[model samples]
Structure formats: structure tokens, C-alpha cells
Target: MLVLSLAIWAVKAQGGTFNYTQPDIDSGKALQDLSRIAKENALKRLSSSSSGCTADNVYFLLFHRVYIWIFEEKLRTTSMGGNGEKVNGSQGMLPGGTGGGCIKEGPFSNYTVNLGPLTARDPLAHNPRCLKRNLNTEICRASASLKNTTEVMLESPNIELFQANLQGDFRYPESRKWGFSVHGGGHFIIAGDPGSDFYFSDVAGTLTMMNRPPSRNGTLDDVLDLEPLGEAYTLGEMLDTVGGSPFCFVYE
Candidate 1:
């Protein structure tokens, strides 16, 4: 009872915006609904009375929430355990598999996680489906260095398209797993561009890694170089053009 009280208090402190429908969720749809809510409302001010969340942004909020709670356990699975350096077993944060995009069971099956956008830096490289490396024949960089020379921006539908295709197993064999990093290399931001007018949105993907750690030196100028190709392409194709795979969160 005390634990439940404390949890309620914590939720209220964190803005109390998320509505937990069914505690025993057996399907992805329920989790998806929660994720949508988290995305619309700013996690910092989640308690605000409004449907500030969206289908695109909610997953990120859930990711941040779950990741922080299992930080110690995930850290242990990645670094401390045997074969931790290599991607094996259910060690990494979200072991990529069927319909496995962001949410994971965490250290314990009861502790389900939405794995928000910030988890791209996981050491194990679990989410290789959307990640791009220099080895990719179609997208591989000319230089040996993994850093990207150009920057790009992706829209919400595009992000959803990528997410939709990646909902199942990886299409390519080479893109199955990450060699160095655990989480995919990308960054999510709350609309850093002015001209684009795309504000307070959650964006993720390889294109964000062009500057190496998208957060440190990214700007609206980066988005200018990126063009929206209406046609869908493989993760490799997407990376080859923009120098990285790109996905963005936007209001519909």
C-alpha cells in the first residue's frame, strides 16, 4: 500500500498526465496508446490538462520513463555480464525481434519499458534495424570514419513509415545487429528549427548522427540539406542519400 502511494506521488510529481488503462497489457496496441499520450504532453509538464501527446511522441516519453528506472539493470546486462560486449541473449535493453521496436521487458518481465528516444546510446546496439554503419554497401561512407558529412531532417509520416516497416524482423541480413553500439545512433529533439516551424517534436534515426551526437551541434541549417523523398527506401538507401537514416516526430 505504501509503495502504491509512493508510486502515485511520483507520477503526480512527474506531471501526472499518463493514464494507465490496463496494468496487464498483453498486446502492443495498449502500449502504443500509452506511448501516444506521453508524446503529446511534455514529460516535464505531463500533468497539464490537455491531449498534448500524439502517436508520434508518446513512445519517447515511455522510453525515458522505463529506461531511467532500469538504468542499473541495463548497465549490468551490457557491461558486467559475460558476453556483454557482444550482442547476445536478452541482455541488451531491447533485444530486436518480431514487432520489437522500442518497448522491452527490461530485467524482469513485469517491468515493461517503452524505451524513449534517448536510449539510442545503449552500448549493445540492440536496435540495428534503423541504424546505419559505414559497412553498408548502399549507404557506407567513403571515408573510413563513421562520422557523417551532411545533416538531414525527416517528417512524422516518414518516421511512421520507417517504424511500420521495422515493426517485424529486419529485412536485411547485414542490418541484423550492431557491432559497436547497442542502441541505434540517433537523437530526438523538441523542434530545434525555426524556419521549419516544427517545434517540440520527437525525432530519431541515423541522419541525426551525421554531426556525431545530434544534440551537441545540430541546428535548423541541418534540416535544409535534407529533402523529403515521397517514395519509401531501405534503411541502407535512406542512409546513402542523406549520409544517415532519419526519422522525425511531428504533429499530425
Candidate 2:
């Protein structure tokens, strides 16, 4: 019976997909304590970093993903007395406006975040402030659909077509026609406030307005170089020209 129970627990721990959800605001006082603990752990990890937290780093996504993963792990263990069962997905209520107003509840409600000074030499220099959020439901609400879109992207038959779709024309409502715009929207919605590291900066925002010509040149490399293209190419290269300039790439 003990071995059977352990087997089931291990499967449950390792098999489930992380379903992203809003932070649970009504978790009460216990959540407050958990928030503090998570924040401290995150801060300690951040302080240990030479880069601190900034968009300049190419590995920003990876860094934060791991950071938050650790934070969530600690939060789960501490809150549930080390049961090791994965906690529910991230929690938070969606706000109604374009501006994602402040977060009022949940595990992170009581904890303060140190954003560090904008001009500080080290991006992680300790500058403490209340953790703020500008919750935009419009974009966040689209997260559900975005998840589905990602699944479709993964199953796409023509890799080149998939890449082209992601590099769709950079326009407003038009830009959203492609997956890239939606990707940026998710970030903006999550980090609606300026102080947040994920805040939608001008660099990414303005790139949406630039016109991108289709690949008139013959090769995938040429397409990436924005050269005129003659034919559609395949996924020979793993590079993602998703937003145009200020590109980021990651390999597993």
C-alpha cells in the first residue's frame, strides 16, 4: 500500500501540465505569509544574480521562468507543509481596463518587490517598493485562446508557413492577426505597469508598426535577413524573427 501510494503521488507530481490561471485572491491570511516567503526567496535569488532583472538580458524569459518556478515551489512546500503536491496555477482576477490596475489580494499581496533604480549600474541594486500590477483583462483573458493557438502552432504541417504566420505584418488590429502580436500582448497585460520587469517597453511596442516584407529571396537565411524572397522556406533555421529587431532565441 505504501509503494502504491508513492507511485501514484510521483505520477501526479510529474505528469500534469501546468494550467496557467489567475492568482487566487481569496486565499486569506495564510496566503499573505506564503507571499512573503516566496518574495524573499525570489529576492535572494535575484540578489545573487550579477545581471539583476532587466530586459537587456537575452535569457530574461528563461531567468524569470526559473525564478518564478522556484518561488512557486517554495510557496507550495511552505503553504502545504511540504506535501510536494504541485499548487494550483498562478492566480489573479482580471481587471476591466487597458491599464491593469494594482493587485489587491493573493499570496503576493503583502510582499514588497525591489525593482531597483532605473539608472543604477546594477539592475538588481536593492530599491524596495510595493509589488504593483496593472491587470488588463482584455489581453489576459485571451490567454485561454492563446494556449489553443500554441497547440495549433506545434501541430502545424508547414514549418515555413508557420514561421511566416508568426512574422505577420506589424500593424495594430492587423498585427494581432499573427501569433507574435498576441505573444507581446500577453506580456503587456501581465506587466502592465512601467515598474515591472515585464512591462511593455517602447522597443517592442513600436516594432509592431514597421512593415515586414515577405521572403522574396530563396533561402531561409535570406528571409531572416529580410531579403526579398522568391519561395517559402522550411524550418531549417531555428531563429525566430517574431518581432523583428531586438530578437531573442533559446535552444533546449
* Candidate 1 regions with alpha-carbon error over 4 angstroms: 1-14, 17-24, 43-169, 177-252
lDDT of each: 0.28, 0.38
What does candidate 2's lDDT look like per residue over 195-251, in tens digits? 533542323222112222121323333211111211222223323434333223342
Q: Candidate 1: TM-score?
A: 0.22
Candidate 2 residue spans exceeding 4 A from truth = 1-95, 98-100, 106-130, 143-176, 179-182, 200-252
The TM-scores of all predictions, comma-separated, are 0.22, 0.32
TM-score of 2: 0.32
